[model samples]
Every structure is written in structure tokens, then in C-alpha cells.
Target: MFGVGMSTAYARKLRWCTLNARFKDSAIVARPGAIRAGDRETFMKIVRFILALAVGIVIFSLTVAAVGAIGHGFYPPPAEFQQIGDRMSDAMRAQDQAAFERTQVELAEAMAAYLPTAPTGSFIFVVAAWITGAFVGGGVAAFVTSWGRRSVAMLVGVADVGAIILVSSLLPGPGWMPFVGIAGSLIAAFAAGTLVASGTRTKPSLSRKAAP
Candidate 1:
């Protein structure tokens, strides 16, 4: 009887051990699955952010262009040569040198007809709009792609700066002012890209395991 009892106890212990082994195996399997799931969630979040940022940047660029176009009306033809030539012809035909000189002065004044002392304000608005838009776009792109945010941001910034400079050149102003605005816009875009790339939120990891 004692031998039989000992055998029964050994059998119970073995069953318990088997159950514990199975539990541990299940726990181990669950842990990796949980980790993988967490990683996937994080990747998805990053992707969404990048997409949002790209859209925002595009919107901002368009806004800047629209504002500039609205502020300055349609781009005028080269007034210095064409309009002046017309005026000179008219003056010469009328036999009036004084009138021709007057026409030149009038043409100069017309070309300088932009609002005075407010160019700085306009520049600020343009730069702000562009930077804000670019930042948002870059952030979204970075969030979407785990890599390449920096390159994207830099590219966008350079393009925007170049565009702003070109537009500024077309405006009626002292030649130096548009160049300055372009420089400022470039600086602002770089800063904005950096900010957006860094702003993407990383996902947290999750895991699970069976208790020992």
C-alpha cells in the first residue's frame, strides 16, 4: 500500500509539472505576439503623422502664393522699357522735350506706387505662413515614414525659399529687399523642417507573459 501511495503521489506531481510547463510555453508565445502588435501600432501612428504634415505644407505654400498675388494685383508688364518708350514716342511726336522728361518721372512714380513702410509687415506674414505650413507637412511625412523626414523637410524648405525669392524679385521694391526676404525665408524653412521632423511622436511598446 505504501508503494502504491508513493506511485500515486509521483503521478500527481508529474501532472502538475506538465501543466506548469504548458503554462510557461503559452506565456512565452504570448509575449512575442504582444511585442509585435505594439510595434505595428507604433509604425501606423508614425505613418499617419507624416501624411498629415505633407498636406499641411502644401496648403501653406499655396496660401503664401495666393496672399502675394492678392496683395500685388496682376504682375505688370515691364514698365521701364515698354511704357517709357511709348511715352517718349508720344512726347517726341508732340515736339516737347520737357513733356518727355515729365513722362519719365511719372513712370518712375507709378512704378514706386507700393505702400510705404509696410513691406516689413508683408514679409513677416509671408514667412510665417510658409514656415508654419512647411513644418506641419514635414512632421506628417516623418511620422508616416520611419526614415527620410529630414531630407523631405530640407527639400521643401529649399524649394519654398527659392520660390519666395523669385516672387519677391518680381515685386516693385528696392532690389535688395526681395533678396533679404528670400534669405530670411530660407532660414525659417530650415528651422521649420527641423521642428517638424523632431515632433513625430514615437509609439510605446506593449508585452505580455504568463506568470511563473
Candidate 2:
């Protein structure tokens, strides 16, 4: 009888030990899956952010081009400058580096002479285009991102500022032009981000309050 009792206790203890081991093994198996899931979520978020930035940049470029085209239509460049542009295009097509460089120098000289004499309206128009583009692009970026909307908007602003500086360097503009562009883009982006965030917050709260 004592031997039987001892055997029964040993069996029960073995079963308990086996169950405990299985529980620990299951927990160990679950940890990696949870970690992988979190990593995947983070990676997807990054992809979404990149896509949003690309879309925003395209929109910004298009807006700037459209507005600048309209400005050009209203305030046409001199015929001499147009001729220079034609030559520049021909030089590019012919792959004549010397001709291209000569045309660029001619264009720069002509612009330097003409811009100071150009109407104040033209300068204002250019600044307006940059501001409009920044506002629209930043707002769109904020709207597109699922998270980090403000950061995305700010990124758009920074991109615009960089582009403004680059273009100003390449093509001569008034010394104050870049500063204005930088300030306008930053303000527009901030306004866009704030507006979008407020709109998003209001919608959700309204819906929740309305829910019975």
C-alpha cells in the first residue's frame, strides 16, 4: 500500500512539472511573435511617412509651377531673354557645353540688369506663389499621414525652404527673397498643421459625443 501511494504521488508531481514546462515554453514562443508584430507596425508607419512626403513634394512642385506660369503670362520676360532661353535649349539638345555656359552667362547678365528695374509686382507675385505652394502642400501632407501629421507638415516646410535657397542661389534674386520665402513657408506650415490637428480632434470628439 505504501509503495502504491508513493507511485501515485510521483505521477501527480510529474504531470504538474510537465504542465509548468509547457506553459513556460508557450510564453517563450509568444515573445518573438509579439516583437515581430511591433517591428512590422513601425516599419509600415515609416513607409507611410515616406509616401506622404513624396506626394506632398509633387503637389508643391506642381503648385509652384502653375502659379509661376501664370505670373509669367501676366508679366512676360523681354524678347531678348526669350531668345537666350531658346539658345540655351538648343545648346542642351546639341550637347554643346561651351554654348550652354555662354548662354547661361548671358542670361545671368541680362537678368541682373533687368530684375532691379523690374516691377515690384513681379517680386510680390513670386513670393505669393511660394507661400501658396507651401500652405497647400503642408496641409495635404498633414492630411495624408495617419500619425505624426505635424512633423510631416514641418518637413514639407523645411523642404520648401531648402528649395527656395537652392533656386535663389542658382538664379539670381533679390537678397531678401530667400528670407521671405523661408519665413512664409514656416508660417504656412505651422498654420496648416494647427488647422489639420484641430480639425481631426474635433471630428473624433464630435462623433464620440454623438454616440449613444
Candidate 3:
């Protein structure tokens, strides 16, 4: 028969293990920053996650390029503007202010054909492309970051959204596109982060039962 003292000791050990498991589980969800000393494996996993986030951004950019090409083919920009744009660049490089200014005005007029007047269908396609790129990129980031902190995956989405804003400013698009694109990017990233974080969570072991 088990003695009273021995039973108490067994219960205490179980309690300690339960608490320890809880702590470790919480740490697993956060990953990275909680790496215990002498745990080189965790440190390397974190490094890989960081590198994965960078690669995610590259993927996003490439997707945007491909999608943009497809969209442009459907609703191409003013054909004449390309030739005028080159002339404008040459004028500026040559320091021919008069020619530069004239070409600039002409280029603006050509671009205007699409801006503030292009069909809503084309605008939808372009905006959707950017959003889709961020969505798919975030998912890839999450998959690669599966072995580490999921929050890091979000950085890719945030960075891409910021880039979208910057590019939009340089080549002004419809006012609404920026708002929609930014919102969509964030939603996609949060979803990816949540999936990876939850999927990696550790469950307490139940394989062994304490002897009575």
C-alpha cells in the first residue's frame, strides 16, 4: 500500500510538472524573445524566421509585378505616354528646361486618360492585385515562420503595405485604392499570424499516469 507521505510527494511533483508545462506552453506561443539560455536551437529558429520575413517581401513584390502585368494588358495605359516619357527623361538629363517642361505637360495629359477617369473595373483589378499579393505573401511568411515566432510574419505585410503607399504617391492612383489596399493587407497578415501561432501551440503531455 502507498504511504501517506509518499502519496503527498507524488501529488506535489505532479503539481510542479503541471505548472512547468503551463509556463513552457506560454513561452512556445511567443517564441524567439523567450529563448532560454543554452538553447541554441531556439535562437537559430528565430533567425530563420527573420530571414523568412525578408523573403516574404520579395515574393509580395514579384506577385505584384505579375498581377500588374496581367491587369495592364487588360486596361493598358495611354500608349503614347511611353514615348513621351522617354523624351521627358532625356530632356531632363540634357538640362533642356524648355523641352522638359513641354514634355512633362504632354506626359501629364496622357496619364490623365487613366487617372480620375479610368473605368472602375480596371481600378478594381489593380487594387485587388495588390491586396492579393499581400495576402498570399503573408501566408508564405506564416508557413516559413511556422517553426518560430508568428508575429514576425506580420512584418512582411506591414512593410508591403507601406511600400504600396509610397509607390502610389509616386504614381498617383485613385484615392480609394490606398485605403482599401492597406486595410486588406493588414487583415490578411493578422489571419496568417493567428493560424501559425495557434497551430504551433504545445499541448500538455498525457502519456504517463502517476502510480497511486
Positional deviation of 212 in candidate 3, in angstroms?
Answer: 28
Show model 1 residue runs off by greater than 4 Å: 1-9, 73-159, 162-212
Off by over 4 Å in 3: 1-39, 84-109, 147-149, 196-212
TM-score of 3: 0.62
Clashing pairs in 2: none
Please give the RMSD to the true structure for each candidate, in Å: 12.9, 2.7, 11.2
Please rank every candidate by lDDT, starting with the best: 2, 3, 1
- Each candidate's TM vs. the true structure? 0.44, 0.85, 0.62
Q: Please, what are the lDDT tens digits per residue for candidate 1 over residues 67-157?
A: 6555444333344547777987999899998989998787666556643434555555555555554554444444445556566555556
lDDT of 3 by residue, 97-200 (tens): 99999997887777666587777877888777777777767767777764644566578779878987896886688788889988887787777767766665
Q: Rank the candidates by TM-score, best first.
A: 2, 3, 1
TM-score winner between candidates 1 and 3: 3
Model 2: per-residue lDDT, tens digit, 109-177? 999889888877777778878888888888888888777888888888899998998888877678888
lDDT of 3: 0.77
